[model samples]
Target: MAPNRGRPKNLYQFHYGCQLFPTETRTQKQLRLALQARTQAETGPTLRRNLNRSNRSVKAAEEPTPSHPQTGTEQHDVLGFNEGPSLWEDTEEILNEEDEVSRARLRSLHQEMIEQQRHRNWKDVMACLFPAYLHFKKLTSNWTVPNPFLNLSSEVCACPVEAYKERDVDLIDLMVAAIDVYQSLKSKERKLTQEVTSTDQQDVLAQQSCPACFGVSIPNNDSTEPASEPADNHQVFICLDGNFQHRHHERASKNYIGIENQTLFVPSQDIESSNSEIREAELAKRVTKKAKDRCAEQHKAADDRRNASTWKGCDDTGLFGCCCRHDSVIAFCNIHKTGEGRGLPMSIIKRLLNSINPNVQVGVLYDIGCTLGKFFKARGLLTNHLLRLKFATAVFHSYVHDWPCQLQFNPRYNNGWGLTDGEGLERLWSYLLPLVSPLRYATRNHRISAINHRSLFHNTLGIENIVLTLKRKFIHALKTKKESEGIVHQFLQDQNPHERGQKYTVEFFRAQWQKQRKFEIEISQTNREKKAEQAQFYKRGEALKSLVETLMDSLAASPQSDPAQSLSLIQQMQELQKLQDEEAAKLGSLFVVEPGAERD
Candidate 1:
């Protein structure tokens, strides 16, 4: 297949300047990769610097002293994988000199391959989309029409289709590509016409918000309304989370850069800036050798303690996402080296807020929202928009936080939250879970595009059935409200005696919640629930000790020495020890236990 000259008449005729992937032969990919490898080898030492390895090699080369014997630099982990230089910090730059060199080389090679002056034959056109496949409507070719389907569509299901389609491994990818291209083209056309699409990049809600939430929110009185509340916007719940499972390996693509930028993702440059800004600020003053939120440092995601070493083979270790209460896909980005960190979420949140009206009240629900809220305030992030935002933990994960944290951040305990669970992203992750393993080996462009495309599909389906969603929510809420009210009324009518002979009313609980919130505010981030627990621990321990001592004295006085008596005493002692242990745990839970702390 000889390549034709002059861009091969961009058959799709995209006047909006939208370019599709060209067809290409295996020769092109092979040649391009070969040249890239040759360039890297030519500039290898300087471009691919290995400071740690070089230092080890140099030390081994030198004469060894009796006190310090020479050691092999080559080491393997328990898994028998070599422990090479992995990106230690989340903020490490991915595009090094070698990366840039390879990227530039590929770009130049593509131009040369497409317009190879002499040839104008079928063989040279091997890379273009095969089947000369065109979206019936858009006429975009899958390949320029020579290129071995380099980008494989991610399998949402692991079931093999080789038996059905024969040996063209990327057949599924080819078929999916046409549909994806059509959808993208369709969306672009809609955007141009100013038609509302279910899948919007910025997630700008052109239509009305969820009916139950802010649609009919009552307007506060003039005096009580926030100064920034221009027209009494109802509260918006935005959930942010990170999924470490959605990662792609560095070896997946060879010096290839994805040309089609995915708008669903936060821009990489913005990611870098957020990371740099946060680092600079922390370095100057707020740097904590000992992080205030140890759980945050230990496990970035909620309860999932997958650390840096977990993704030794991957470049993108995870993803950070932001979404509305309806579980619609909003802005998200591939988290560089870290699991769940401050940079990506903050960047996404700030961008979403900036894109829309400042008057829109946003409540951000994260697994560790209470901790993040404090961090944001301390770092002076979102300072201007702080008034419009409320931070809260998702309902399911709220139990992980102490009572004080629950009072402040748990949606269930808070007023105006209604029935928002804040676990929307968790459900969203399940939808994308199928893309995890397959995408780990796919190209960077393929990974991002696949996620964005799938997310778009999710939103489209969600929008189409939004009315059904509202009806179900309304019915569920009504049932829950009735059942809860019945229980409350039953308790109110009960003759059960009160603790202090005082009546408990709804007003009493409301005032109590306000008082609890005030106390939480007065205390620092670490101090919440710990002081109360500590006091309780000492008081309980003293009482238990006194009781044990009194029982032991009584036994001694009787001088009882029977087998049955000894067994009874042993049982009683065991119960006391268990009680003491539990009381001690209350205090222990407040502090962050470092690795190997138990052994120490």
Candidate 2:
């Protein structure tokens, strides 16, 4: 706690009897206890085998030191053949594609590639140290931390075998490469298992998609819900949004290897193509300079300022991600040196459409769905695919749009959205928040690979919990439907019948919605002066309402206040009264006399 010394106060408390062996630090003690617990949790036979070996899985309790590192001779070397599943025969290789090769050599080659990549860029700066845990626990069955490959330079720090060639972090990065390979092989094995039980043809969408959202293969014991329904359940709803937190600083890393073009991401070239299209439209005078509404203009200006200025030193501005309704990542693309353009989401939608079955309905919900829908329809882009797709703004975000936009594009007002709020990708961004800082300095390939890995893990978890997710969603929808129907019924009952004995039925409200939509669309197109006048009226009305609410809040904020705070509150009320008087003057002497004026 001392400022100048800035060291733990308890550092000198521990005393050792002798220095024959290096004493365990806090980290080592914790790790040893963790490993010892794991050893105890194992079966009795495995525990006996581990106990027989002097250096076994629980070796962290007593790591070999720099003075006398552990060594293996042919006489004492631990050797065994752990047979891999026959399905590994078809799994893809890291860099090698040659078949019928030794698995050990393939592993060696993979490790070599990981080392080369590590040394080339992240040798010192960004190498991942040996993490506290591995990605997959299955690998831990045969894993040992105190292996000969790792050198315990001290109780605290670790180095690799080649005499300080790599730090513990580098060893961790090396291990990630092995994990990546292991994960791929396990996925292949899983897909083979699915093949035995599944009847339908398999593809990326069919395999990776959530069973609840798309359709389950196995029967739901509940029995009422359909499992053998059409692919994508007749409609595919996706959430699209931009996140600037996952940007990369240009000065942090330098590599021309280009980002990996994989299933998890849309290629940079494809997104760049959309950007080019936007620029060309502007040049050709096909794009309008006028914004659709004040909200649209404000949103665009804010985006422009954020993307252009906030990340001047960064090459990647952010990311544009698309996720299915069940929060499974469909695809995402990196935004390069620019704010999100119309090109990004449009390109991603085109990509999604091209991937899914053509006949199925596709609903895309984004933050600015109304504006994007207009832009798409005006440009006549994606002509062949547009017929089957519809656009809606996300439920929470729709309020940010003008009333007209909300009426046209908000899922709450529109049909077919079904309680789908379209905020799934926001949850995804929260999942990637931890990667934000590290990825800003990571190599481009590593950044993409890391995101892909995280997304894969998230999707795997989504698949595992999909049935529960569907059950929850169904319950929520049913509850909401009942409450809404009751409220509507009560409202209808409360409405008085007209002189002609005509009731204000649900059909009447539907007709009113249609009429209001038509009037708003017409007014938006033709009445600029009227729109401005109406905006001012709404602004003044909101000000008055806000002033009333503020006064009420301030009155209740401190019912038992002191004299000085009481004086402050009185002055605040006077200021509010003065503003109200000014607003009244703007209303052309609506009040009898000037309010809040001096009595004299």
**Which candidate leads in TM-score?**
2
Q: Worst 10-residue stretch by lDDT in candidate 1? A: 11-20
For candidate 1, the lDDT comes to 0.67
lDDT score, residue 118, model 1? 18
**Whole-model lDDT values for every prediction:** 0.67, 0.68
Against the true structure, whose lDDT is highest? 2
lDDT of 2 by residue, 256-349 (tens): 4545565578888888888777677665657665545555565652366655777788887788898899999888888888887788887888
- Which 10-residue span in candidate 2 carries the lowest summed lDDT? 10-19
